[model samples]
Target: MPNAPAADQRRLLDVQALDTRLDQLAHRRRTLPELARIAELESQLADLHTALVTSQTAVADLRRELAKAEADVQQVRDRAARNQARLDAGQGSAKDLQALQHELESLAKRQGDLEEVELEVMERLEAHEAALAEVTAAHTQLVDGKVQVESERDAAFAQIDAEVAGVQSERATAAAGLDAGLTALYDRLRGQLGGQGAAALRGRRCEGCRLELNPLDLDAIKAKPEDAVVRCEECGRILVLLPEDH
Candidate 1:
């Protein structure tokens, strides 16, 4: 492809500037404050959910235990009632009566032990449920906060997108002056070189690489016509020569 005119070649610098602005806008969008806040909140929400699940499980287990303990007490109480009915009828021998009395006492003791277990389980379940409620409420708060943060993040992205659109329009205007082949080369090189394809030759140094050009290469570059676009030896970016460049 033919080289672009000397004046049009400098237009490439304007295009490069616009591209850099676009890159900065993208960076700003990614680093928005809401992005970090959302990330931190998401992590906290996960932990809270885990805690809620654990508390719920404990409460369920304790409920089952309480139910079983209450059932055991009821069974023992029923047996003691039947024994009392037999004693009230007074139809048993003295030996039988004494044995029945001993059995009733044993049943009473077992019932007391079971009732104690039932009360302990009830207290534990109540505490576990209360803890679960607290965690759930906390989780709800975080969820709401995340929603707000996401909304703010979207607004930030929209702002950056608008700026990007404006910069892209400017880039198009700058690119229009260059030959198709020149812009194509620049785009390809920009992709390969971290969003940069050109830099001005400032004094005796290649600004793209911040390197002082060797004497032989520098002399050869100086000998080229003003319209001749050159590539930097150190970094291979299109080297733009300003009028004051030596």
Candidate 2:
């Protein structure tokens, strides 16, 4: 059997591997592209809603103006009819009759002006209605896009979570099989080494820092006992040697 220190070193390496995988899963969850797209869609939707409200308000104001103008025209016509009846009944002096006729002519002109204003208001209402329709269409498209993106994002997160859960379960099992003292040492070293407590030495290189070992360091590691755990001088990471066959 390997010495206690060598066994602890192996367990630390396994823990490091699991930690790396956890970091990757966390990064994937945090930086999803679909989430950014969803934020953009929501902003556009809010702008569309504001534009729609403004356009509808304009339409309502135009309608109100048109109704008021039509009412004023009807009132002027009624006044003119009353003046005509008074003239036919011979109830006014000649000068008064002339004044009434002049007033009737002025009222007719005013009615024409009101009708022109009403027409202009109706044109504006039509333009606002057209703009509202366009905004509504755009809003609908964005809503549909948001729905699709949300569904895809949810599914992606769910899959990532499932993978993380499975890996965590396996890591727990591995931990259970390790010696208690070894596990404690690994946990302490992991905290001290910025989450990476162990590393593999491949081809005279430290995998953690990707740095090649100096001649002296190589000689020192070579002279160490087989079951004597050793650390990389440069990176302070437990360095595992390759098997004899590979």
Candidate 3:
């Protein structure tokens, strides 16, 4: 058995209380609601970014298609206009003039067909542009939401950190000047038993495990000298005996 001054044994209980508070604070930090919300927002942003890129690419490809269609229509119009001007000037023999008239008719038909293709490409391009705009707006909204959430999360972190620092200072003070051998034993047991190295023995109960000691065990513990360190059989934790009036 280990020995410690009874006063040091009582002070161990104070250290245990402070240590438990620190553990609780750490757990709170890990499980904060802001952390979960941030993760969810990040996932949504990733998927939205992919969609935004796809919309932009589609709009660019359609704009290039429309440009080609417009060029094709303009080329046919220019050719038809030149043919009509030559026919009006009457600068060729009858056979040549008749051939010119026939060629002008063919060019007019070609221009109409090219115009139809250009109209179709323009319509497709307009629809894609609208789609791209809508996607861009949605992406911007989500980005703003993420920034707001991040700010809130940062504020929460600052509050929790301040509390943790305060608790750590108190724990250090509580553990100071404690018996070296008892402190070592307590630290070792805490590492082994879920952050709880010592608990009070109230009446016939072992507070560490919340179990009632058998009469024989209770009497044996009571018979031990006050300075003799005692452990509970139920939980193997150091048990500090309190005064009856306490």
Q: Report, for every candidate in turn, its global Cα lDDT versus the true structure.
A: 0.86, 0.79, 0.89
Local accuracy of candidate 2 as per-residue lDDT tens digits, 1-246: 124445556666777798889879989999899999999999999988898888878878878887887788788879888987887786888999888889878888887887787788888878888888888888889999999999999999999999999889878866666656556655676788877777888878999889999977888887777666667888877677655402
Which residue runs does candidate 1 get wrong by more than 4 Å?
78-104, 212-223, 243-246
Best by lDDT: 3
- Two-way TM-score contest, 1 vs 2, winner: 1
lDDT of 3 by residue, 10-116 (tens): 99999999899989988988988878987898898899889889988988988898898888888878887887888899979988889889998898888888888
Q: Give the residue spans of candidate 2 off by over 4 A.
A: 1-5, 46-50, 77-102, 177-195, 225-228, 242-246
Off by over 4 Å in 3: 88-100
Per-residue lDDT, model 3, residue 192, is 97
For residue 156, give model 2's deviation from the true position in Å.
0.9
Q: For this target, which candidate reaches the highest TM-score against the unseen true structure?
A: 3
Alpha carbon deviation, residue 151, candidate 3 (Å):
0.9
How far is 38's C-alpha from truth in model 1 (Å)?
A: 2.9
Each candidate structure's count of clashing pairs: 0, 0, 0
Q: List model 1 lDDT by residue over 1-246, tens digit each.
A: 246666666788888889989989988988899999999999999999899888888888888888888888899999999998997787699889888899989988888888888888888888888998998899999999999999999998898998899999988878875877778888888999999998888877887789999888988988888778789988989888877763
Clashing pairs in 2: none
